[model samples]
Target: MMTHIVSKATYRTHMIALFMCLTFLWPCAICLYCTDFSRNVDHYCSFCNAFIGTYE
Candidate 1:
């Protein structure tokens, strides 16, 4: 019984970590890629343009 409870808690912690990574990390990655591509092509993608002067 104690082992089962511990396992559940561990699983919940892992899930929270996964959720945080997906939520926060993916956006930064996308922004970086969008900016890099825009710089190379001399055209700002909509995603990069939308974020301009935002929260800066």
Candidate 2:
């Protein structure tokens, strides 16, 4: 019975770790996607250089 309880706790910990990993990696994936989009926009925009110079 103690082994069974420990097994369940281990399972829960594994799941929590998986969820945390996904939570962290998913935002990085989204940021990369957005970065790609922004790069595309900068490449296409005629006045992008001017805008970046003023803002950044």
Error of 2 at 54 (Å): 64
Q: What TM-score, computed on C-alpha atoms, does each candidate reach?
A: 0.28, 0.28
* Candidate 1 per-residue lDDT over residues 1-56, each given as its tens digit: 11111111234344545665688865544444334322222222354343222111
Against the true structure, candidate 2 has what lDDT? 0.35
Give me the runs in candidate 2 sitting further than 4 Å from their true place. Answer: 1-9, 25-56
Cα displacement (angstroms), candidate 1, residue 5, comes to: 15
- List the candidate 1 regions with Cα displacement exceeding 4 Å: 1-9, 25-56
lDDT, candidate 2, 1-56, per-residue tens:
11111111234344545665688865544444334322222222344333222111
| lDDT (Cα atoms) of all candidates against the true structure | 0.36, 0.35
| Candidate 1: residue 49 lDDT (0-100) | 45
